[model samples]
Target: MTTHVQLHDRLDYQSVMPLMEELKAITDDDLVIDAGNLRHLGTLPLQVILAAVKQRAARGQTTRLANASDGCVDMLSLFGFTPETLTQPEVWT
Candidate 1:
Protein backbone atom coordinates (compact mmCIF):
# COMPACT_ATOMS: atom_id res chain seq x y z
CA MET A 1 0.00 0.00 0.00
CA THR A 2 1.03 3.58 -0.51
CA THR A 3 1.13 6.00 2.40
CA HIS A 4 0.32 9.61 1.76
CA VAL A 5 1.65 12.56 3.75
CA GLN A 6 0.07 15.86 2.90
CA LEU A 7 2.36 18.87 3.16
CA HIS A 8 0.93 21.78 5.03
CA ASP A 9 1.02 25.42 3.91
CA ARG A 10 4.06 26.08 6.05
CA LEU A 11 6.65 23.37 6.05
CA ASP A 12 9.05 25.03 8.45
CA TYR A 13 11.13 24.02 11.46
CA GLN A 14 8.19 23.46 13.78
CA SER A 15 6.68 20.84 11.49
CA VAL A 16 9.83 18.86 10.74
CA MET A 17 9.84 16.50 13.71
CA PRO A 18 6.26 15.37 13.36
CA LEU A 19 6.71 15.03 9.64
CA MET A 20 9.82 12.92 10.14
CA GLU A 21 7.94 10.68 12.53
CA GLU A 22 5.18 10.32 9.99
CA LEU A 23 7.69 9.40 7.32
CA LYS A 24 9.34 6.88 9.63
CA ALA A 25 6.03 5.14 10.21
CA ILE A 26 5.56 4.53 6.53
CA THR A 27 8.84 2.73 5.90
CA ASP A 28 7.06 -0.39 4.79
CA ASP A 29 4.91 1.25 2.16
CA ASP A 30 5.39 3.31 -0.95
CA LEU A 31 5.23 6.96 0.07
CA VAL A 32 3.42 9.77 -1.66
CA ILE A 33 3.88 13.35 -0.52
CA ASP A 34 1.05 15.69 -1.44
CA ALA A 35 2.71 19.02 -2.17
CA GLY A 36 -0.16 20.89 -3.73
CA ASN A 37 -0.83 23.01 -0.64
CA LEU A 38 2.71 23.91 0.24
CA ARG A 39 3.42 27.58 0.69
CA HIS A 40 6.74 27.66 2.49
CA LEU A 41 9.40 25.03 2.14
CA GLY A 42 12.19 25.33 4.68
CA THR A 43 15.64 23.85 4.35
CA LEU A 44 15.12 21.43 7.21
CA PRO A 45 11.88 20.15 5.80
CA LEU A 46 13.49 19.80 2.41
CA GLN A 47 16.30 17.81 4.01
CA VAL A 48 13.79 15.56 5.68
CA ILE A 49 12.01 14.94 2.42
CA LEU A 50 15.28 14.12 0.68
CA ALA A 51 16.26 11.81 3.49
CA ALA A 52 12.94 10.01 3.29
CA VAL A 53 13.35 9.54 -0.42
CA LYS A 54 16.85 8.16 0.00
CA GLN A 55 15.78 5.81 2.76
CA ARG A 56 12.89 4.52 0.71
CA ALA A 57 15.19 3.87 -2.20
CA ALA A 58 17.60 1.91 -0.01
CA ARG A 59 14.71 -0.22 1.12
CA GLY A 60 13.58 -0.84 -2.44
CA GLN A 61 10.51 1.31 -1.90
CA THR A 62 9.42 4.47 -3.66
CA THR A 63 8.67 8.00 -2.60
CA ARG A 64 6.93 10.52 -4.83
CA LEU A 65 5.81 14.09 -4.74
CA ALA A 66 2.36 14.76 -6.17
CA ASN A 67 0.60 17.91 -7.25
CA ALA A 68 3.36 20.27 -6.26
CA SER A 69 2.31 23.82 -5.69
CA ASP A 70 4.11 26.61 -7.53
CA GLY A 71 5.87 27.63 -4.35
CA CYS A 72 7.06 24.12 -3.85
CA VAL A 73 8.18 23.82 -7.43
CA ASP A 74 10.01 27.11 -7.29
CA MET A 75 11.76 26.31 -4.07
CA LEU A 76 12.83 22.96 -5.42
CA SER A 77 14.07 24.56 -8.58
CA LEU A 78 16.23 26.90 -6.53
CA PHE A 79 18.05 23.80 -5.44
CA GLY A 80 18.21 22.55 -9.00
CA PHE A 81 15.41 20.06 -8.59
CA THR A 82 13.01 19.57 -11.44
CA PRO A 83 9.89 17.43 -11.16
CA GLU A 84 11.81 14.66 -12.90
CA THR A 85 14.83 15.12 -10.63
CA LEU A 86 12.66 14.96 -7.56
CA THR A 87 11.54 11.46 -8.46
CA GLN A 88 15.03 10.14 -8.83
CA PRO A 89 16.61 8.77 -5.66
CA GLU A 90 20.03 9.83 -6.88
CA VAL A 91 19.02 13.48 -6.89
CA TRP A 92 18.66 13.41 -3.14
CA THR A 93 22.39 12.88 -2.88
Candidate 2:
Protein backbone atom coordinates (compact mmCIF):
# COMPACT_ATOMS: atom_id res chain seq x y z
CA MET A 1 0.00 0.00 0.00
CA THR A 2 3.04 2.22 0.21
CA THR A 3 6.15 3.03 -1.81
CA HIS A 4 9.68 4.07 -0.90
CA VAL A 5 12.27 6.21 -2.71
CA GLN A 6 16.00 6.38 -2.32
CA LEU A 7 17.92 9.55 -3.03
CA HIS A 8 20.86 8.44 -5.05
CA ASP A 9 23.84 10.58 -6.00
CA ARG A 10 23.87 14.04 -7.52
CA LEU A 11 20.51 15.55 -6.64
CA ASP A 12 21.04 18.78 -8.51
CA TYR A 13 18.76 20.61 -10.95
CA GLN A 14 19.55 18.08 -13.63
CA SER A 15 18.23 15.20 -11.57
CA VAL A 16 15.64 16.79 -9.28
CA MET A 17 12.54 17.01 -11.46
CA PRO A 18 12.60 13.39 -12.41
CA LEU A 19 13.36 12.48 -8.84
CA MET A 20 10.41 14.54 -7.70
CA GLU A 21 8.13 12.83 -10.19
CA GLU A 22 9.35 9.45 -9.11
CA LEU A 23 8.91 10.32 -5.46
CA LYS A 24 5.30 11.24 -6.12
CA ALA A 25 4.57 7.55 -6.45
CA ILE A 26 5.16 6.98 -2.75
CA THR A 27 1.97 5.89 -0.98
CA ASP A 28 0.98 5.90 2.66
CA ASP A 29 2.16 2.41 3.50
CA ASP A 30 5.69 3.04 2.32
CA LEU A 31 8.05 4.05 5.09
CA VAL A 32 11.70 4.87 5.78
CA ILE A 33 13.17 6.08 2.51
CA ASP A 34 16.90 5.62 2.23
CA ALA A 35 18.54 8.84 1.12
CA GLY A 36 21.89 8.42 2.78
CA ASN A 37 23.66 7.60 -0.44
CA LEU A 38 23.05 11.00 -1.92
CA ARG A 39 26.38 12.62 -2.57
CA HIS A 40 25.56 16.04 -3.90
CA LEU A 41 22.19 17.30 -2.78
CA GLY A 42 21.26 20.86 -3.72
CA THR A 43 18.42 23.19 -2.92
CA LEU A 44 16.38 21.69 -5.70
CA PRO A 45 16.63 18.29 -4.11
CA LEU A 46 15.47 19.71 -0.82
CA GLN A 47 12.55 21.30 -2.64
CA VAL A 48 11.69 18.00 -4.21
CA ILE A 49 11.50 16.39 -0.83
CA LEU A 50 9.49 19.29 0.52
CA ALA A 51 7.09 19.03 -2.38
CA ALA A 52 6.65 15.34 -1.73
CA VAL A 53 5.99 16.01 1.93
CA LYS A 54 3.47 18.68 1.11
CA GLN A 55 1.80 16.48 -1.46
CA ARG A 56 1.50 13.68 1.04
CA ALA A 57 0.19 16.10 3.63
CA ALA A 58 -2.43 17.32 1.19
CA ARG A 59 -3.61 13.78 0.66
CA GLY A 60 -3.54 13.09 4.40
CA GLN A 61 -0.90 10.47 3.80
CA THR A 62 2.32 9.72 5.66
CA THR A 63 5.82 10.01 4.24
CA ARG A 64 9.10 9.24 5.98
CA LEU A 65 12.65 10.22 5.12
CA ALA A 66 14.94 7.55 6.48
CA ASN A 67 18.70 7.21 6.65
CA ALA A 68 19.14 10.75 5.51
CA SER A 69 22.72 11.85 5.83
CA ASP A 70 23.51 14.82 8.02
CA GLY A 71 24.64 16.75 4.98
CA CYS A 72 21.30 16.19 3.31
CA VAL A 73 19.48 17.31 6.44
CA ASP A 74 21.66 20.38 6.57
CA MET A 75 20.85 21.11 2.96
CA LEU A 76 17.15 20.93 3.75
CA SER A 77 17.61 23.15 6.77
CA LEU A 78 19.39 25.70 4.64
CA PHE A 79 16.36 25.78 2.41
CA GLY A 80 14.11 26.50 5.39
CA PHE A 81 12.64 23.02 5.71
CA THR A 82 12.28 22.22 9.37
CA PRO A 83 13.11 18.78 10.80
CA GLU A 84 9.55 18.62 12.06
CA THR A 85 8.27 18.38 8.51
CA LEU A 86 9.95 15.04 8.15
CA THR A 87 7.95 13.45 10.95
CA GLN A 88 4.68 11.62 10.36
CA PRO A 89 1.63 12.96 12.15
CA GLU A 90 -0.23 10.46 14.24
CA VAL A 91 -3.56 12.23 13.72
CA TRP A 92 -3.60 11.36 10.03
CA THR A 93 -5.07 7.98 10.80
Report, for every candidate in turn, its global Cα lDDT versus the true structure. 0.84, 0.67
Query: How close is every model to the real structure, measured as TM-score?
Result: 0.91, 0.72
lDDT of 2 by residue, 1-93 (tens): 767676786788888778877876566555456778765777777767766766677777777777777776776566555345555433322
Off by over 4 Å in 1: none
TM-score of 1: 0.91
RMSD (Cα, Å) for all candidates, in order, is 1.3, 4.0
Best by TM-score: 1
Q: For each predicted model, how many residue pairs clash, with residues at least 3 apart or on different chains?
A: 0, 1
Q: For model 1, what is the error of residue 80's alpha carbon versus the real structure, in angstroms, after optimal superposition?
A: 1.4
Candidate maximizing lDDT: 1
- Provide the lDDT at 67 for model 2: 76
